[model samples]
Target: MDLLATQQCIKISQEIGWTEKRTIETTYEMKLFNDYLLVKKEKFPVTSIFDISFRKKSQTNDIGFLYLHTNSGVRTYFIKEEPFSLIEAYEKLKLERPELR
Candidate 1:
């Protein structure tokens, strides 16, 4: 599988302690392949993937949710920033290589 694009997602750990001001941020990669989407370690095949969506971080929302809708189920991943690049790349991949989908 050819790597098409990758999105960096940051998850800040919440802490409630005076000893540590803040916990270290965790990093995760959302990768788009020729026929699959890999979120960290788990991989979802393109054929099973139905749609991908995102929600911006707001006062109510801590970190936005990157919703991956698939045949199995909807998986939500916390993302610190907007994943416009990943979305664009995926769309382009679909346009350029329809067979991959």
Candidate 2:
């Protein structure tokens, strides 16, 4: 896996939602292992940041990366690529993190 490319994809994913086209392009070479999409980078590699995965529920169509900023201790905004209803996304997140409820 290309580290630069994957980082770029992550940055973009954080800024905008991961569309079907972007997902295919970013994870084209990545191997799906269990729940995470595995990407191996060689140069300047600092572990995997995009290792987390999510399930697409029928209630939500909005898809994007969930970034947890450790340094700032704040949750970043969901970058949306295509137009989608965010209500379902919010519900899904709440369901995933029951503590937040």
Cα distance off (Å), candidate 2, residue 58: 6.1
Clashing pairs counted in every model: 0, 3
As a whole number from 0 to 100, the lDDT of residue 66 in candidate 1 is: 85
Clashing pairs in 2: 17-79, 17-80, 17-81
Q: What TM-score, computed on C-alpha atoms, does each candidate reach?
A: 0.74, 0.21
Worst 10 residues of 1 by lDDT: 56-65
Q: Where does model 1 exceed 4 Å of error? A: 12-24, 57-62, 97-101
Error of 2 at 11 (Å): 11
lDDT of 1 at 29: 96
Cα lDDT of model 2 by residue, 5-101, tens digit: 1211222332345653443333222222222233344121122222233333344435455343222243332333421323343334446654435
Q: Could you tell me which residue pairs clash in candidate 1?
A: none
User: Model 2 residue 2 lDDT?
Assistant: 20
